[model samples]
Target: MSAPLLEVRDLHKSYQLKGRPALEILHGIDLQLPAGECRPICGRSGAGKSTLLHILGGLENPDRGEILWKGESTRGWDRSRWAIWRRKAVGFVFQSYHLIPELTVEENIRLPAMLAGVPLEESWEDLLDEVGMTLRRDHLPAELSGGEQQRVAVARALVLEPELILADEPTGNLDGASASAVLDLLVKMVRQRQKSLLLVTHDETVAGRVGTPLRIADGRLAGNRS
Candidate 1:
């Protein structure tokens, strides 16, 4: 068996709503993932699935726990450290197509590498071709359909070739057909890239196709082990 690429131990998180007690979201979440493994998480609305994804992606902090990336702890990582880690190791996709409307599809896809101060990858064109958006490369987000935009988002997520992808409801906003297409594209891309995927979604059909199905409730996962 291979070693885990990422691991979380005894993770806990909570939030304080105004005038209310601290509401715990995650309760001692322990997870592990090997290279190229896809882990699908399903939960109802407000089930803390997104919270776990955000924490795993380094976009949010855990109140208490340990996140180990290749056996090294991220306990006290500063913003710079987190930024570097994100640029080099993590890719994130969201329910919303967060493309910059001002940028062309090509530009939007290249933004991560640009921000990371890295030159465009040699595989840049390959990614564009993979997403079947080479013809729309110069079009702005507004010019594309919802599915096209999501295809672009998936391409952008893979542009940096990050080792791990955290997708939170990537198909939520799309219609049935568009969601199916996007979901298929995402799964195909992840498998082709050999990247680890931790997907948070509510759709059973999508979950059934992505990876091993695991349920999340109150921020804890069931039917999932490592």
Candidate 2:
């Protein structure tokens, strides 16, 4: 059998206060994500859902544990190494569309590829078309609707063709129809590309639409292996 695309073992993270005991956020999280699979992590606010996503995407570090990519451990990897890997292997989408207000749609989507020193070839156009943003290519984030801006963010996330995508509350800011549309597009794109997805969401309906639904409570995966 093929190895899983991503693995987490005994993952733990804590925040130390200035003069108090450390606050534990994650408690020995163990997970496995196969290629071409989508996993929706559902939990209440402050349940460490976003923390797990951030750690997996290299935006933050775990206090103790191991994260393996295709069987290679990320232990002891320096910040620069993590940055390089994130650029090439992981894509992150936030609830708030993090597009540059000044940059046009095309520029926003091309930013990752540009940072990675990749050429702006057919892939750019292809992504714009894929996200249905071809006509909005020249518009700024301020000029687009919430759903449209999120679509641009999604395009930007995929610009690098990363193997793993970590999305945190991707539809938190949109109405029902727009949220559904954006999420459907996200799932379609990731599945068609065979990329692994770990999405953090609070809405049960949203969680149910994704592949596997995992619940997190008190910093531990509920009703599943911890």
Candidate 3:
């Protein structure tokens, strides 16, 4: 069998308060995500779900243990190396959508690809079509609906053709119908591209839609479920 796309071992993280001891958020987490698979990490607030996702996405580091991308350890990689890896190997989607309000949908979607040195004209058209944002390509984020904004975010995330996508509550800000639409598109994209996805969400129905569902409680991953 081939190696997993991502492996995390003994991952731990903590933050120190001004007048008290350090508050440990994650405790010895171990996870393995195979290539092209989709997994959901479900948990309530303060469960360290977002923290875990950030660590896995290379946006943050664990105080202890390591994250292995493909087969290489991320421990010794410097900031620049991490940035390269993040750009080339991973894509991230967040609850807030985080789009620059001033930029048009197409411009926001093309930003990541441009940063990665991919010509804007090369992938923008195809991505806009894929995410059903072709009509709103030139619309600013403020002019679009929540679902539209998220569609643009998805397009941006995929512009780099990353091997793994870490989405932290990608649909959290949308209404029921809009959230469902966003999730459907996200799942379809992941499956079609054969990219691994790890999503952290509080919605049970959303978690159930993934290939595998795992819960986080008290800083530990619960048993996997179908």
lDDT of each: 0.89, 0.90, 0.88
Compared with the true structure, what per-residue lDDT tens digits does model 2 show for residues 7-75?
899999999999999988999988898887898999988889989998998888898899998888989
Runs off by more than 4 Å, candidate 1: 224-226
For candidate 3, the lDDT comes to 0.88
RMSD of each: 1.4, 1.7, 1.3
lDDT (Cα, 0-100) at 44 in candidate 3: 92
lDDT at 120, model 2 = 67
List where candidate 2 sits over 4 angstroms from the true fold. 223-226
Mark the 10 consecutive residues where model 1 has the least summed lDDT: 217-226
Q: Which candidate is the best by lDDT?
A: 2
- Candidate 1 residue lDDT tens string, 1-226: 6468999998999999999999988998888888898988888988889899888888899999999998888987998899899989988899888999999999999999889888985789989998899999999999999889999999999898999989999999999988998898898899988999999888877888887788888678787554
Q: Which lDDT value does model 2 have at 40?
A: 91
Q: lDDT winner between 1 and 3, please give it.
A: 1
